[model samples]
Target: YLYNGAAYLESTFAAFKQRLVPVNVNYRYTDAELVYLLDNSDAEVLVVDTAFVANVARILAELPNVKLIIEVDELGEGPNPAGATIAGLVHYGAAIAAAAPAPHIERSLEDLWFLYTGGTTGMPKGVMWPHRSLIGSGGPTFKPFGFAVPQSIDEFAALALTVHDGAHDPIRLLPAAPLMHGTSAIASWGVLNSAGSVVLLTSRSFDAAELLSTVQRRAVTNLTIVGDAFAKPMIAELEAAEERGEPYDLSSLRLVVSSGVMWSQQTKEALLARADVACADLLGSSEGVGFANSVAKRNRLAPTARFRLGPDAQVFNDAGERVVPGSGERGVLAVGGPIPIGYYKDSAKSAETFRTFEGRVWSVPGDFATVEADGTITLLGRGSVCINTAGEKVFAEEVEETLKRHPDVHDANVVGVPDEKWGNAVVAVIGLEPGVGATEGTEAELRTHCRATLAGYKIPKRIIFVDSVLRGPNGKADYRWAAAVASDDR
Candidate 1:
C-alpha cells in the first residue's frame, strides 16, 4: 500500500520505467478488502509503506501471487523499524542502491496504466489507461501552462528542458488529494511530464495549515484537491490565519483544480477572495477527458454545478436522443474523447460504462445533468445515488450542496431511507462547524435555510447531525454509511 509521499511517486515511476504494472492499494481498506483488490488486480509484487505493515502481514498469506515485497520506511533510517517484522521484505532505499542500472527498454503506446475507481458503492474496478489514450487525454491539462502535447520522445524531452532553462521556472504542483486516486495521480503525471516538481504532503491525513505552509514555502504554482471536503478546511484555516493577522502567502498558486465530487461555488469564491487563484472544478470520473468543467476566478465566476461541456461531451436521455438545450430534461452526461480501454477483467461493466451512444463510443459514468440554453450543464448527483421519494426524484448532491450552503454545516451527505408514506424519505447526515451544538431548533433552522434554494420535496425530511460526516479518502461521499445510519434511525 502506498501513502502520498515521494516514495509513492518513486515506486510509480519506477514501475513504469521498468515496464511493470503498478497497482494502487488503499491504505484504509480492511484485510479482506486489501486481499480482494490485490488478488483481483493480479498484483505480483507489493511495495508497501512500513506504517501499514500490520495489515499486510495479516493478509500476506492470502496473496500467493505476490512473490516479492518491498518496504518503504516513512521514517528516516532507524534501527528495528516496523517493517523488520515482515519476513523476506527488502528495504526500498537499500534495494535501489544495490541494484544495477536499468537497461534500455522501448516503451509502447499500448502500455497499460491501471487506475482503480473509488468504489463508493461497490468493489473498486481497475480502469485500463493505455499510454496513447492517457497522453492524448492530458492535452487540456497542460495547455493552460503553455505546454504543448509532445508527439515524440524527442519533443517531450525538449519541452522538459525548456521548462528548466532558467528563463522559465518549472511549475511546482502540490496535489492535496491522495495520489492513490486518479484525480491527483493523473495531475501529478502531467506536472512531472513537463519537468515540473511534484510536492507531496508528508502528513498522512490532510492538514490545511500544512498545505498552505508548504505552498508558501515551496512556491507551488499549481494545486489539486477533491471537493469541499478539502476546500472547506482550507478556507477555515485561511480565515483563521487572517484573523491572527498573519495570512498565508499564496501568490505563487495560479490554479486550484478539483474533481471526484461537487465543489460548491461558495467555497471557490471564498478562496478567490483570500488568494488570486483560479478554481477549476472538473466534472469527470475514473472512467474518463471529462464531461464538463467550471473555472472560477475573481471576475469570471461560474455558478455551482454549472459547467461548459467539452467538445465531445453530450447528454443522452432514455430514448437515446441528445438532451435539448433549455429543455430541463435530465440525462446521463457522456464524454467521448480519448477515454479508457475498459475495466481490467469485467467485460459487462466495461461495455456498460464505455458504450456506443448514437454511433459514438462515449465513457458514460452515469452522472445526471441538464443542458442550459447557453450550452452549459447543471450537474445533479450520480445516477447510482439518486433517491426516489413519493414518486419524486431527488439527487443527493443537489440537496447536499444546498444544505452545505448553511453557515453552521461543516459537511453534509444526503441519503434515502424507507418511509411508509413516501417509500423513500430524504435524510441528511450533517457535520456542524467547530463548537456548534446541534440544538432542538437545529433541524428547523436547517430546513428553513434549505427552503430558500431547494424545493419542498427536495428538502431533507430528517436531519441527523453527527460529529462529522464520513467520506472516503478521495472525498467521495460515503452514501452507504449514511444510508445505514438513516435506516437505523427510528
Candidate 2:
C-alpha cells in the first residue's frame, strides 16, 4: 500500500475543489472491512492504488453503489503483482487528462467531509465534518502560529495569498502518521487551507531516517506524529546517527505536534535536547479537537500526559455533574465549542458521542481523566481499556507509563487478563529497547520498577515480556493484541 503521497493528495484536493465529499480509507483494512466502509459510506466512486487493486477487486461485488473505479498505477507499467483487474477500470492519469474543465459553482459551508475512524472494537465510523465546523475546530491550528482567525471567505483568501506575495512565511509540514488517520489528515487539511506546503513521505511505512532526511532537505517547519510510537523511533535514529558521528540537521523544524496517544516527557526531553523545536502534545480525538494541549520546550517541559484544558473543555462525572478540580475523581472528558456535526448514518452512536451538556452540545469520547490541584488534568487512558482488578481500578496508561520509565523498556502495554483470584488481573506486555534481552528475573525487575510510582493494586500482577509491543499504524495502542497475548500465555 502506498503512503498518502501525491496521488492521495491530488484526489483529496480535486474532490474538495469540486464540492465532492472525500472519504479516507484505511490501507490496512481487510476485504471485509473495506467492503463495509465503502458500503457504509454510500460511496459512488473509488480511487485505489494498483498495489491494493487485487483486494479491491475481490470486494468489488459487494459494493453496488460504487459507480466508478479510478486506478492509481503505483506499481510501474508491468502487469499488477496480483494480476487483478476490473472491467471499465479507468487510469488515474487518463481520467484526469481527458476530463473536461469544471464550471464554476458556488460552494456551501454545509458540504460534508467524511472522516472514517476505527476505534478499538468496532467497524470504522465516518465522522461528519462540515466546512463550517472545520473553521471552528481548525481555529487551534492557526492560534499557535499567531494568525488571526478569518471571519469570512474574502478574509481567508486575502490572508492565504500573503504567502505567495512574500508578505507571510509559509508553513511546510510533514505528517508522519498515515493520512487515513484523523490526526494526520486533519493536520494536512489545515496546512493546505492556510496555503502552506504539505510534504509526504515516499516510503510506504514509517522510516526514521527518511523522515529526518526529508526534514533537513525540505526544510520542514512543522511535523505531525502520533505520540511515543513515532517519537521513540525518531529519537532512536537521532541517537544512532549521533553515535555514528553524523547528526541530522533539524534546525529548520520549528514545531512538532502529536496527538491521539501518550507522548512521554522523557521522549519529549530527548528531542528538545537535540533540536530547537517546540513539542505540542494535543489531547483530543476525531469527534473533537482542542480539548487540551501541553506545549514543551527544553527549558519549559510539562509532565507526561498533563495538559491545560481548553477554554471550552470540561470533565463530567457519570451523574452529569461537572468534576471538581483536585477532587481525585475520574470522569469523561468533553469539549463544547466547535464540534463535529456527528457520525454519518449512525444516529445512535452520534447521539451517544455528541450530546447536550447543560445547554451546549459537547463531544464525550469516553476518555477518563482526573483533575490535579495545579488546575491541569492528567489523562488516565480510555475507559474501554481500564482494568478492574479485585474491585480496584487500574488504568493501563498509568501502569504503562510507569513501566516505560525504566531504562531498558522501550514500550509497554497493560491489559486485564482473566484471573481466578482477582476476577481480572492487571497484566503487562512489555517490549525492551534495542539489544536488551529478557532474563528469567526480568519480570520481577520490571515489577520492582513499577512499584516505585504505581499503587500496590495498580502494579501489574503479571508481566509478559515480548520482543516488541505492537501498535496501530496511526501510533495508537493495540489493546486487543495485548489482550490476546496475555490470554494465550496465561
Candidate 3:
C-alpha cells in the first residue's frame, strides 16, 4: 500500500483481491487518467489517493467509467481528507474492509498475470506470468536482496509493517527499495509468501540513524541490498550506531544478503565486519538467466574460479559447442535450475538468448565466464563489452572492481574507446562518494594502483572522473546509458 508506483501497487493488490484487479490511475493523469485506467482494466471502482484528487479533477470526463472513486487517507496514519468537491468519493480503507470477502475460485496454476515491464527499455509490454511457470522456472533462481529507504511516510509505515506484527511475534524485514525493481519486488513477495509484514516507504530518502533505530526497535533479522552503492553507507551508519552507545540490537540479524550488483571484496569484508550474517550472491540477468556464488565459492575455486572444474561452470566455443575438459576458454554463463519466462512481446530476443543445452534448456546470460581445472566458475566479466586493448583482451569489470577498492573511489566503470596506438584504449569512468574528489594526479595514482593488481594492458589508459554511474532499476549498470552520457560530457 506504501508503494510509489500506483500501477504496480494496484497490480499487487489486484492479485491479493483475487477477483478484482486493482487499476491504478497514474499520478500524472488527471481525471482523464481515470478514463484510461478504467477503460484498460475494465474496472468499475476507482481508488484515488485523495491528495491526488485535484490532479484527477482536471480530466473530469474520464470519471464516467468510475462507479465509485474511493479516496484514500494520509495512509495508515490519519483519516481521509475532508471537503472534496467531488461529493461521491468516500474513504478507501473502510470500503474495502467492509466489503465481504469474495469466495475463492478454482484457478489454474498457469493462470495468466499481467506484468508491466520497464517502459524505459521500450514500450511497456504486459508480460504474462504464470504461477506454475514462475515456481518451476524462476523460484529457485531468486536470490533476492532489497535496498530501500522510506520515500514517504506511507512508505515508512509500509516498511514498519514488514517488521512489526505483534510484540509476541518475531521481528522481520524492513525491505527498502522501489518495488518496481525485480529484486525488491521478489524480496517483498518472499516476505509475504512466508506470512511476514511489509513496511511502506515515503520520500525515497534514507536516514541511517532512523533506519538503524527502526531495525533495533523492530529487532530486524534480514536486510537485502545492492552490494556497491549501499554497502559503504550502511557500514558507516552501523558504525555510528555503535559509537553513540545506542547500538542497534542487531543480534537479531541473521543474513546480510546481496545480489543486484557484484559484491566487491571490500564490501563483502565490510559486511562480515559488522554482522555475522551469511551473504548470498545470486548472479543473474534479465535475459531469462540465473546463477549464485559467493566468496566461499570463489576462494575454494582457487587460481581460476572462471576455469576451475565445477559442475556449475562450463565453456562454450564459437561453433555452438561446449568446450572439452580444461579447455580454458571463456564462454557465456549458462544457468541451470530456475529461469525467466523470456522477454514479453519479443520472441526473437527470447530465441537468441535462451536455448536447450545438454537436453535441458538453459538461460544463458551473456557473461563471459570460464571453468578452471577445479571446475570453479571464474567470471571474467560480461561478454558484451569485452575490450581488446593494446593487443591484449581486457574485461572492464575486472579492472573496475580492482580500481573501486581504492579509498578515494566509490565505484568505477571501465570502457574501451578507439585509440591510434592500442586499437582500443581503456577508459575509466569513476563515481566518487560525497565529499570525495579526484584529479588527473589521482587518476595517475589509480593507474599505479591498478598496475599492482591488474596487468598493465588491462589498466585504464585514460580516466575520466564521472559524477555518477547509471544503473538500471535492478541496479545493473546500463552500459548503453553510460556510453550515451559519456558522449554528452565530451
Question: TM-score of each candidate?
Answer: 0.95, 0.96, 0.71
Q: Is candidate 1 or candidate 3 better by lDDT?
A: 1
lDDT of 2 at 33: 86
Better lDDT candidate (2, 3): 2
Query: Between the candidate structures 2 and 3, which one is better when assessed by TM-score?
Result: 2
- Residue range 45-91, candidate 2, lDDT tens digits: 88888878788788888888989888887546543555345778888
**Candidate 1 clashing pairs, residues 3+ apart or interchain:** none
RMSD per candidate (Å) reads 1.9, 1.8, 8.1
Per-model lDDT: 0.86, 0.86, 0.58
Error of 1 at 356 (Å): 0.9
lDDT of 1 by residue, 1-490 (tens): 8788889898888888888887878777878788888999999889888777767777888989888888887666342365556678888889989999889999888888898875557788999988777787778756854767777999788877777676467878999988898888888887787778999888878899999999999999999998889998999899999999999999999999999777888899999997898899998788886778889999898787779998779999988789999999999899987888899999999998898887888898888989989999888878788899999989998998888878798899999898999999999999999999999999999999989988899998899988988898888888888988887776
RMSD of 3: 8.1
